[model samples]
Structure formats: structure tokens, C-alpha cells
Target: MAAELYPSSLTTSIPNDPAVTPSSKKSIIQEPDQETEPAPTSTQPNANSSTETGSRWQASHPTLRERNALMFNNEHMADVHFMVGSPGETQRVPAHKYVLAVGSSVFGAMFYGDLAEEQCEIQIPDVEPAAFLTLLKYLYSDQIELEADTVLATLYAAKKYLVLALAKACVAFLETGLEAQNACVLLSQSRLFQEPELSQRCWEVIDAQAELALRSEGFSQIDPPTLETILRRETLNAREAVVFRAVVRWAEAECRRRGLPVSTANRRAVLGKALYLVRIPTMTLQEFADGAAQSDVLTLEETHDVFLWFTAAVKPALEFPAVPRTGLTPLRCHRFQSSAYRSNQWRYRGRCDSIQFAVDRRIFIAGLGLYGSSGGKAEYSVKIELKSQGTTLAQNRTKFLSDGSSSTFSVWFEHPVQVEQDIFYTASAVLDGSELSYFGQEGMTEVQCGKVTFQFQCSSDSTNGTGVQGGQIPELVFYG
Candidate 1:
């Protein structure tokens, strides 16, 4: 990867998809009256903009898309010359210094800082031309396509150039794209560039799929700091012994790179810090005796301490054991939403999505979103309950904000509610007052064979009448 000085123009045709995209679908909450915007981090462009864009795209008149294309084609306004890529392989992108400076703090400092007076060519030898072109297009047009193939390079360029918006977009792109294969590679890249969101998503993937990550070819490329963070995280889905085994595996692979025998003292020295990060006292007594004592990495005192603790000869300090994070089940926690708004909705404001767990979990329910229309000057109160078979397991009550919008309603539980396995847990909400007309997904939910979820509707008979099917569930967010 290298480059030299030259002047040329390039096109942004590469892929780098964001988590959300523009859609022509109408907002659940009506347009003019609804002040609630979608989550800012939503990859999808605003529904309002998307609908207008779609209409313009279908019309016989000039559209924003055409205007954007025209700007890309019209290179007469270009000022700066960006020579991107390696020496003989470089592509020159014609850009304005103003665009560059405005898009990036690093470019701003270079072009208008103390060194501003000394004119210099913009040569980016390390950046891929495809990526730089995408950045240029975003700077010039305020839009760029984020896809799987180009996001990494685009992210790298975004971070290096200090393009915060593009950096955020890239993080959103990588969040949905993370998997067993690219988790380690992306984690390393995220760490290097200091993208906290991307780093968090990568770590979550690693945590959720620890065994797969440990087996990944790129696992050995994980940096020490990232590895330490992973080891320290309590939410690692795998058992303690499995983590210890993974640490040993990573250390041995690292030793091989240094051309030393895995059992050598030098190798153990390299693994000392990582080995200490593993909770020795948490391992099975057999695991400590067979695994820890056998690995020459542990010092005699450390090994003795673990042995003493396990044998009750010494009571180790009460350490907060890292509880397994069962919060990674997005499939179980998601609200069933379809773009097509139809009759499959609750006539009443109160509804619930009941889920029977296969295992016990510390359940935290995020407030539900209300569907349907809003009214003028109305008050509403929600009484939420965790019930099983006509018995009240747990309950909470709260008043809706003055705006009467239920879309942003949320209450973080002081303590996560303990839910039991093989038991029916219903998150029932009962609404009072003429606040808002809440909707639900009536018969759209397809409960799989031997599945756990059921729709529970508590109230709505007043307005919707006998038409209410008690089976339709409303939208609710869950984190456990």
C-alpha cells in the first residue's frame, strides 16, 4: 500500500452498507403530529425523507439522487488533489481543500493549521482508493453506501481522517455485520482505531460466540488489551475452564510465532498476565489440579492458593463472580414488527408478549411502544405485571409523560426480575385514561413448533369492542 502525487477524479461505486437504510414506509406514529424521531443510530434514513425521495425518484421531474450524481460528475469545482494507494497503483481523486478540511479534523489541521502556509500535496499512501473515494463522495454529497466489502477500509480511512460521522456510520455497519469469522479481525481493527461502538459490538460477538471465536483463524491476531478485556468480562457465555483453555490456546499460538516451545519458561512468561486474568478459583477442583497445576505457567504460590481455596483450607475474598450474560438472545427479546400496518393490531392500549424461558434469566423489560393515533390532552397510566397462571408474580406502575406519546416510554428496573425456566411468564400491561390508542400485531406472529411466546392482551374492550382477539401483542423491548 503506497501512493505518489497526481491529479484525477474517481467514482464511489463500492459497497459499505449501514445497519439501517431508507424506506418509503410510513412512521407508526403519524407524521406531522409525531415529534418522536427514530433512534439516531438507526442505520435507516428518516421515513419522511425516504418517502419524499422515493416519490421524487418515481416522478418525471429532477430528483435529489440526480442532483447528487450531477455533483459527482461535475469535477470543475474540485481544488485539492488526493493521490491514494501505493506508488504505481495510486488513483487520484479531485477534491476541494474546504471539503477535506470540513470533513476531517486531521485534514483541517494539515490544510489550515500551523503548516497551512506551506503548500503540500495530499498523498494518502495507506488508504485504498475505493475507500477514499467513498469518503470523498460523503464529504461532497453527504451520502455514501456502506456495505460488507468496503466498510473496513472505509472505517480505517474515516478514523485516520477524523471523519466522525462516517466513523459512526461505519460502526453501525460493522455492528450488524459481526460474526464468528470477522469478530476477531474487526475487534483488532476497532481497538487500533479506538471506535468504542464497533469495539463493543465486536466484544459482544466474541462473548456470545466465545467457542467459535477461539477456533477462528484470526483469534491469534487479537491484541493483548482486547484479550484482557474479553477475559475480564463476566458475560462470556462459555464456562471458566473453557476460557482457561482458550487462553492457553491463544498463548501457545503466540509462542509459536516467537519460535519457542509452548512449554518453555519464556512462553509461560509471555502467558503470565493472561493466565492471571483467568479466574483460577472459579475452575473445578479437578480443573485446577489437572489443568492449572499441569500447565507450568502458574507460580507455585498461585497454584497453592487456588488449591487451598478449593479445599476450604482458606476462604478466598468474596469475589463477584462474572454471571453469564443471557442478554444476547435478540431473537427472544425482539418485538414482532411488520412494515405493513394492517388490522393485526391491538384495539386496546394494553398488551403483552409472553415468553416461556428454556432457562432462568434475569429479565429486564424495556417499555413498550404504542401503535395507532394520539389524542389531545389526555392522561395515561400503565400497570405492568409479571404473571403466571392467574397469579401475580411481579408488578410495576408508572404514568406516561405529558406528551402522551408511548413510543419513548422506558423505565430501567432497579433490579432485574428473576424469571424461571419451563414456566409461563407474562409481561402484562394495563392502561388507564384516554391517553393514546395503542395497536398490536394481531395474528402476524408465527409461533414455531414447541415455541415459548404467546400474545397477552389485558384491556381494550371499551373502544375496540368484541373485535379484540386477546391474542395480539404490542411492541416491547427486552434486555436481560
Candidate 2:
């Protein structure tokens, strides 16, 4: 198979074997006069060979990798220069053609194939200097050190060179750090790179925590196609109003990038087809009246159509989809199997029923499932909080009127809290009620809900009858 070169302008065509076709643009750099060491040749010893001879051979000759490492950036035997980076930030990296050829088939075809061009320097304007150096290090020493800031750039360089191992490593690193904060940005890159698995993982986080992901600064930086993809997603868990606001923010950013004034017209122009995917008619009448109408992004006719569709018995034909999105249904992960209403037990006196929990992957904690009053219909004022290391991540004060049943009642937070992997968080709830309620028994230390596995531990703040063994907090409602 013929290996394709990145920056298609760099080469016309090169065979799979050792050869390269240089770019049309070329520059010559004077070669340094330094003593050069010949490339090392390795010979394997016989299986019956003595340990003494093997030790002597090892002492006299360093491994091939060690020699390659020594010649990595050394100009001693370098025959080519790579002019990497952009115009003002260019860097000339000296490298041995044979070593790079041995590591990457693309490099092999570029430097020593049948159609190889005899150029002293190759212009690499698309890749960063740091990322290029990292690639060279991996090729020379079979080792790579990746940092969060430059890993994406390094991945680009790896894919360009057809370095499959390094590219896989970069993808793994990115997947490990995937979260709601960076999922949008990663989703864009993953789609650009044709990495479907990474894109799907990113979509999972974005779908579960749509509001948070859309509100992220990275969402505004996504390309137009990626923005459209998000808008068209039917499983997004955010409300239509939130989606419209995020799209407006993205359009404003895009207008500024294009050096246009931030006007309603400019925003609509930048949004283009993406604006139609917001499902404005699906939004509540109050939401549409308060947000979309005041924004001025929608024209008078479009606004009128939406109002008629909402109130009029005969709905008008609208461009936007009127149906609400099929948002994610959070899974209720019960930590206990049985519940009991003991006499004088499960009484709430405002003491917090807290339990520490952690997950193996990023998930949105929508709410908590608690046992309601078993002594007839009762109303309780509840304060629910999620904390990490004493710092409150999310808190909500609400009221729930239990129907005096054995089923768990879900009390939701104002917004879902994004829980990161392996980070311990405390879910605490204080219920102010006069009735003795059903308490959980036969508590579990771990519960699997869909793809997320939550591990529970006893919290020091649990002063009431709520804990890993027995508690009022029976379940954690979450969307993975």
C-alpha cells in the first residue's frame, strides 16, 4: 500500500518502500563538519552461548536504541533538516534519514523510496516544534513523554507520520482525561481525525451533561460542522432554551473571529443551518417569550409562527422541529435491597444523611432517591448537597410531598452535578419532617448502574440513620 503524506502539497506520490518526493518549495542549509559515527549493526547470539561472552559483548557495545538516542538531534550524521512550525516560530530540526525511515513507513517512503527527492530540508509548516520533537524522540528512543497541553498537537504529528503506536497512545491519553469540561472540544477533534470511538465517548458525556458542556468555553470554539452536529442531536439532555443560548454565544464568537460586528444579522448569518436545529417551538411558551423573543435573532414572522404553534389550536407550519428531544433518563442506582419502618426509627431532626461515593467514569448526578414518609401523606423541606473534600459542588433546597408509599422518591437538584472519575464526593441530604419514614437495610458497598460503577463509603457527616449499612439515602440517581 502507498503511504499518503500529510500536507498533501509536500509530495506528489511515493511508494510504500524507502523513498520520498520532496515539496516544490525548497531551502538549503549548510552542513556542519563534524565527525560522524556509522549506524550500529546488531547480531544475535546463539541460544547455547555462554553468559560470560554475552556480558562481554553487552559491555563493549551499547544497544541500538542507545546509539539512536545519542544521534537524535545531533548534527554529526544528520543529512536533512525539517523546517517545522509556522512563519515566525519556525525551527530547524536535524535528523538522520535512516533512523526515521526504520520507525515510520511514511518517513521511509519520504526519504529513501523509489520516488524519493534529494532535498536538504523539508518544510513542515503544519506541525508544532514541541510536538515534532516528541515524535522524533519516540522514533529514536522508543519512548515518549506527553503533556496535556501538547498531546493533541503530538497526536496530529503522529498521524501525519503514520506512527500508529504513538497515535494510539495519544488517543488513550485523551480518552483518560475526557470530561464534561473538554468533551465538546475533543468531540470536534475526534470527528476531524475520524476517531469514532473517542467521538462517541465524548458524546456520552456531552449528552448526559448537556447544559454544562454547552456552557463550557470550549463549546464556543468548536467548528461550524461540530456545532451543527450538537444541535441536531436528539438525545441531548439540555432544554431548548439552553441550546439556543449556547448557539447564540457560539455565533457571537464566530462573528468576532471573522472580524464582523456582533449584530443579530451577523449572529444568524454565522449560525446558518445550525440555528434551525434549536427546536424553538419545542421550548416552553414562557421560555420562548422570555429568551428567543427578546434576543432578536429570530425574525418577526418566525417568532409569530412559534407563538401560534404554541397557543393556536391549528398549529402553523414551522421550519424548526416542534417535538421535544428524547433526553437521557437517569438510572436510579439503589444501594439497598430492603426497607423497614421501625417504630421510633428513621425520624429526621435536620441531621445530614451523607454518604461518600465515587465512580469509574464521568457521570451526571441528577438527584438522590430517598425513602418517603410511611406514616401517611406528609410534606418535607429538604436540603440536598454534593461536596468534594469539604467544598460544596452543588446544593439545592426543595420540598417533596411523599405519598406514604414504600417506593423511593426522587428529589432533583436545580441542575445535575458532574462527577469526575475516582474522585470521592459526599451526597448529603437533610430532611425536616415530623413523620418517621422508611429506612434502607442490607446496604451495598457498590452498585452498578448502566456503564457506571459507584463505590460507596461511610461519611463522617452522617449523624442521622443514613450510611453504607443502613440509611435514609437509598439511591443515587445519575445519567452516565
Candidate 3:
């Protein structure tokens, strides 16, 4: 019985017209033929039906109309869904006709610009409708999703479309990604694309990762054209130039360190080619030696030349400036005078000795005599002494009696001499204790001639006389 009822229910058919038989109308009401009729793609009528259960169904069986209405509503709903989630933009674009939203359509237009003329459809990835719409927003307003990873490629495509905003977004992404550790590929692409900002960012990253740059074999990996571009960049200073030179030099050093046959034909040729291409600073050993001898400081380029030259000529020369002189004489005072002191039974008054002394002063004293017997032969000896007060400081005695009895004596104080003030060469000597006297051709500093005991006769005979010619004792004179 169950199998028979299932067949009957499965074959149930709704009447096409309400004027049909009663059983046909009842079948349309209860056991409708869902299998025979085309199902509505919008919704199925069952437990969740809104178009079911009512006396309004008997008047007209509105299945086809209802289905058409549901389909139209669904299409409308689809339009609304896209408006909220995946909506795109279109315009009666200007003469340029470029003001279109980004997405598959824009990319398709771009891809079409350079594509072969005749094509049916383009095979592209199934981009999310939402993402495609987001891209369209970007094209229309230059707004982008910050967290969207595919935005970079989308920008690239947009850039191809000559969209200025999309190009800028691409540049920003490349530069930001270039800052990361494993962003060499991205940076390389940026450089290839001739993006100035991205290239600068990549160079900054290279400068920051010096060790990584050194280890990467990137020096050799970079072609001559690329290196030329980098080297020609005027932004590099002396320090950065040194780093650049080091990178190129490392390739040669690495070859040697690895025990590679650097002298081989191919290797030598390659090296020569590199030398020409690199335009690294070059100096002969002689030129380097001359530079070192002449200059204390050199720029990085000059230093590179010197290093290269030394590698060839193999000289061990140190580079530095010469040290300059550094030695110290004792001060000598030949003539010195202190404040005057008093001694002896008699008092002596004087001011400070106002004699200006010179290092080349000549002070000499002549012979000093005592009596007629000429005590200077014994006690009348011409004894000159330098004294501080009554204390004898230095004394020298020189006998001035000539063998021919022609007395002539003099003693010069060659260095310096001092004398007391107010009592200089006075008619009478000031005696602190004894007067200093000069004897003829002797060392006497002063003379006291009032003590003469021998009377001088005005006779030329050999007797004691005050005769300037024949009769002579010892005439004394002073020179100050």
C-alpha cells in the first residue's frame, strides 16, 4: 500500500487550467507534480513557503506567474546584495574614457589594451566579488584596503591602466615591504619598474643590512648596468662610497680565499672586464707611494686606489703624519746686589745702588799701594775682594811690581760690577769697614793714598820720587 501511494504522490500533477477536472484541481492543491514542473530557482514551497495555504489558490493556479515574479524579485535582491557588498561603478566617461572602477573589468580593459585584437573572453582568476568591488572603489576614489594582500597586484594592474592613485599605492607597498628582511624580490621588482621612491627605500635597506649584503654574493649578482646606475647616484658620500668599494672588492677577495684559480684565462678576462666596468679607483704602486709621502689624509676613493696599488706592488708602508719638535737653558746672573748692610765703628749712609748693569760691562782697577817702602811688595799687595758687607765673598791678589820698576797694573771685571748709590767715586770713601782700592795693574778695588809714608822728590834719579818718567812706584787708575 505504501509503495502504491508513493507512486501516486510522485506522479501527482497540478492542473494547467482551473477549468480542468476536479481530481486534477485536487492534485494541484495537495500532491503537486514537482518533478514534472520546472522548479523556481528563487525558493521552494514547503514548510518555509509564503505562497502556500489559502482559499485564494482555487480562483487561479498562479504557479508560472508566481515563479516568474519570484525570479524577478531574486534578480532585484541580487542587485541590492551587490550594492551593499560587491557593487561596482560605471560612468559616461570623458574623452579619455578612463574613469572606470577597478576590478576584473578594469584589469580586463588594461590587459586588452596590449592584447591581440580578436578574443572572446579572458581567462582570469576568480577574484572575490567583494574584493573586485573594493578595487573599484580604489579606482574611483583612490581608497584602498590596508590589510588586503592582493592589493599590491591589483595596484600593479591599476598602474598598468595609467591610474595615478593605483601607481602610488603600488609604490608605497613596495617601499614598505622592502623594509622587511626577505624583501629582496620586491625591491628588485621596484628597481626594475623604475620606481624612484622604492629604489631609494631598497638602497636604505641595503645600507642597514651591511652584513647581509656582504654575505649574499649580491655584488657579483648585480649586473654592470645596475651597478652603474647605483654608482652614478650622487647621494652617496665618502663613507657610503667606501662601503660600495668594499662590496666590489669582496668578490675578488672571496675568489682568492676560496683557493679558486684566479689566473685562469676566463677568470682573468672576467676580472679585466670587471675592472673596466666597475670604474673602481685605481693607482699604481708608485703613484700610491707618492701620495702617501705627500699627503696625511686621503678620501675613500684615494684610499681604495692605494689599497689596490699595494696589493700589486706588495709594500708595507704606514700612513701617518710626521711628529714635530719639542727640548728647555739655565738663567745666569753674573752681577747681583742685595740691600745694603752696616758694619765697622763708623756709620755709612747710602741709597740703593742705582747703577744699571749690562752683561758686557768692563770694570777694572789698577794698583793699590801703602807706604814708601811699598808695603804692597808684602802687606801692600794689591788684593781685590768682592764682599757682602764685611764678609769677603771672592778675593784675588795680584802683585803688580814690575821687574824694571815700571809699575803698571790693571784688573778688569769682565762680566758685571755693582756700586753703591750717593757715594759713587766720592772725594772720600765711605768705609763700612775698609775702603776698596785699585792698585796699578793689579786686583785692588779701591785705593787709600793718604797713608803714603815715602816722600816723593821731584828728581829723575833712582830715588823715591813723584816723577812720572824715571822714578816710579806704581801708578793706579780706575775705569768704571
For model 1, the superposed segments whose C-alpha errors exceed 4 Å read: 1-79, 86-91, 98-109, 112-114, 117-120, 180-192, 199-218, 256-263, 299-479
- Per-residue alpha-carbon lDDT of model 1 for 1-480, expressed as tens digits? 111111121221222322111121211111233223221222321224444345344453244433443334234445566678867978766656766687678878878898673544477787777777767666645665565656767777887777877777777666654565567767766766677777776675666556667666556656566677777776665557767777777787767666677774766666666666677667678876888677777667666666667777556652324243342442233343432223443334453424322223223343344332245345556666655666765566766553533343443222234343345455555666553344433433333222334333333222333122322234444433
Q: Positional deviation of 155 in candidate 1, in angstroms?
A: 1.8
Candidate 2 lDDT over residue span 1-480, tens digit each: 222221223222211111111112212111133223333221111124344234454454366655665566666557888888877989888888999999999999998999885998999887878778878877876665666666767778888899987788778777877767778888877776778888998898889889988998778877788898999898999999999999999998888877889998999999998899989988899999999988989999999989999999999999998889999988988999899897788888878899999999888889998888989888889999999999998889998989889888899987788788999999999999856999899999998888889899999999985789897889899887
Give the number of the best model, judged by TM-score: 2
What's every prediction's RMSD, in angstroms? 16.5, 10.3, 44.6
Worst 10 residues of 3 by lDDT: 321-330
Count backbone overlaps in model 2. Answer: 8
Q: Across residues 1-480, which tens digit of lDDT does each residue of candidate 3 receive?
A: 011100112112111111111111110011133323332322221223344324354244455434322322122212111221112431111111123422335444543466522432222232332333334444433344432334434444444445565556646644433322323333444554557777665554444343344344434334334444444433332133343344345444434544565443434333433333322333334544554323423446555655654575653343321111110011121111111212221121321111111112222222122212221232223434333333432344443332322133333222112222222221111112122222222212233333211111222121222122221123322223
lDDT score for residue 179 of model 2? 69
- Comparing candidate 1 with candidate 3, which one achieves the higher TM-score? 1
- lDDT of each model, Cα atoms only? 0.53, 0.79, 0.32
